[model samples]
Structures are given as structure tokens and as C-alpha cells.
Target: SQQGEEDPQALSIQEGENATMNCSYKTSINNLQWYRQNSGRGLVHLILIRSNEREKHSGRLRVTLDTSKKSSSLLITASRAADTASYFCATPGTGGFKTIFGAGTRLFVKA
Candidate 1:
């Protein structure tokens, strides 16, 4: 499967702490994207790293890609209670418009 799966389906942390998640896939992909969704809100794009890229960072979030192993990781530093939400990893489909989302890692950041 070209789709990837994330470890630790759930996570809980105190405000100001860091959270890390890992993902693994079975096949090659064009790029991988991280998204955040709050409760009922729509998924918000966090970052997108192409296959050739090794690492990327944005604000308090850091993402790393290892195409040789077909895996990736996302790390969020200094998390806030407002950061409490479900995070997902997606890989664009062959058709481009389609992307496959994993079950997601629900993160709860307590104040």
C-alpha cells in the first residue's frame, strides 16, 4: 500500500511540552502532508514535504522524511492546549487530487 500508518493512535501532554509521532508506508509517494483538525473543524494543512526533501520545519512543528525507509515523522514543540486535536499524515494519490489519510493520532494538550 502506498498509504502510511502512524504510531500511537493517541497522545496526551501538558502545555509547553513536545509531542512526536511516526509514520510508515509500504510504497513510494510523491509527497507527504501533515494536517491538524480540531474537534469538528475542517482539517488544516500543517506542512507538505516533497519526496526529495529530507527535513522541513514550520513554527513549532518539525517534519522529517526518509524516502529510503518510506517513513516520516512529525514533532510539535511547546504545544498549547489549543493544539489539542487530531493529526493526520496524507500522501497524494496517483490521480493527484486524492490523498489517503491514516486513522490519525488524537492529541490532548492540557493546560
Candidate 2:
């Protein structure tokens, strides 16, 4: 059972613009994380925002959490063609030490 579910199933943006993706979950979570995956490759951890934290930033990525709403968002600034990939939200759940991922948002940054 996937813990998080992402919105806007797909996205297309011009390079240098910003891309934002959202996730919503069901159940109480201790932490939420965002990840990026290039085609035919493994996911790369982008950022982790805890339930107690509202916002966090790393490089061009910004993550925000609102446990009250069971929602989170990831913002990527100055997007590039290289940023073309699928983004997913993850949560560790009762799935027995497994992390479940939401249906990803496929982003295409047009050059």
C-alpha cells in the first residue's frame, strides 16, 4: 500500500521556470520525503521534511509540510531540461519497514 499520493499526474514547464508538485497522505506520519527519478534509473532523495517542521530547503529544492492537512509540496526553482524526471512523495508506514511511494508526477522541462 502506497503511503503518499501525488497530484497533477504530469507537468510541463519551460526551462528557468519553477515546478511545483503536491502530495497528500492518509494516516499519521512521522516524516515525509520527496525524491526525483530520471528515466530508467533509481530515485534520488531530494529532501525530507518532518512532521514537526513546516519548511526546509536544499539547493534548488524547497519542501513544506502541513501535517494538519496531511499534505506536502515540493518546489523546484530555475528548472532545467535536466530536471525532466518523475517526482514522488514517500512515507514509511506499517508496511513492515518498507517505504511506500505515491504515484509520481512526471515533469518535462522544455529546453
Candidate 3:
């Protein structure tokens, strides 16, 4: 089964600062993905890091995966008010057909 849990259910940061979110899983995973969801909107894929990869970057977003520890972290640089959203981590379940999502971390950026 796919099981991922994100820590710090809520976070508040100021604009121009950095925001960090973490995820921990119970079982081995081939890959992990991070997503952001705006209020009343869809979840936007932020980054994906494979089991063999330690760190990946996209734009201002950085993701690190540690298979040994079964954990991952996402860092958003230069936070903005518009970046306020709920962030989630996902991993494929058994058979690689199901995607399980974490409880998500609600982030609020103050301008």
C-alpha cells in the first residue's frame, strides 16, 4: 500500500522567504511526487524524484528524496503570496496503479 504522511500540517511564511515541507512514507517507493493545490482548485504537480535520485530542482522548487529513510522534502525559494496553497506528496501504491496522497501541508504566505 502507498502511505505518505506530511509533517507540520500548516505553515506560515513571509514573502521572499523560503518554505519547506517534508514527507515520510512507510514502504519502499519507485518515485515520489510533490504537488500544490490552490484554494478551490486542482493539484499542480511541482516535482518528481526517483528512487535513485537524491535531489532535483525545477525553477525555484527543490526536492530531495531519501529512500533509506523513506522520506522526502520540498523547498520553495522566494515565497510569494500567490504561492500560498496546500502541498501534498504522492507515491504509487502496490502494482504501481494507485497513487496515494499525504494529508498535505497548508501554507500561507504573507505579503
**Candidates' C-alpha lDDT:** 0.91, 0.94, 0.95
**Model 2: per-residue lDDT, tens digit, 14-40?**
999999999999999989989999999
Worst 10-residue lDDT window, candidate 1:
1-10
Taking the tens digit of each residue's C-alpha lDDT, what string does model 3 give over 1-111?
A: 439999889999999999999999998889999999999999999888999999999999999999999999999999999999999999999886899999999999999
User: For model 1, what is the C-alpha lDDT against the true structure?
Assistant: 0.91
TM-score of each: 0.94, 0.96, 0.97
Candidate 1 off by > 4 Å = none
lDDT of 1 at 34: 93
Q: Give the TM-score of candidate 2.
A: 0.96
Ranking by TM-score: 3, 2, 1
lDDT of 3 at 66: 94
Q: For model 2, what is the error of residue 20's alpha carbon versus the real structure, in angstroms, after optimal superposition?
A: 0.5
For residues 4-59, what per-residue lDDT tens digits would candidate 1 score against the true structure?
A: 78877999999999999888877789899999999989999999999999999999
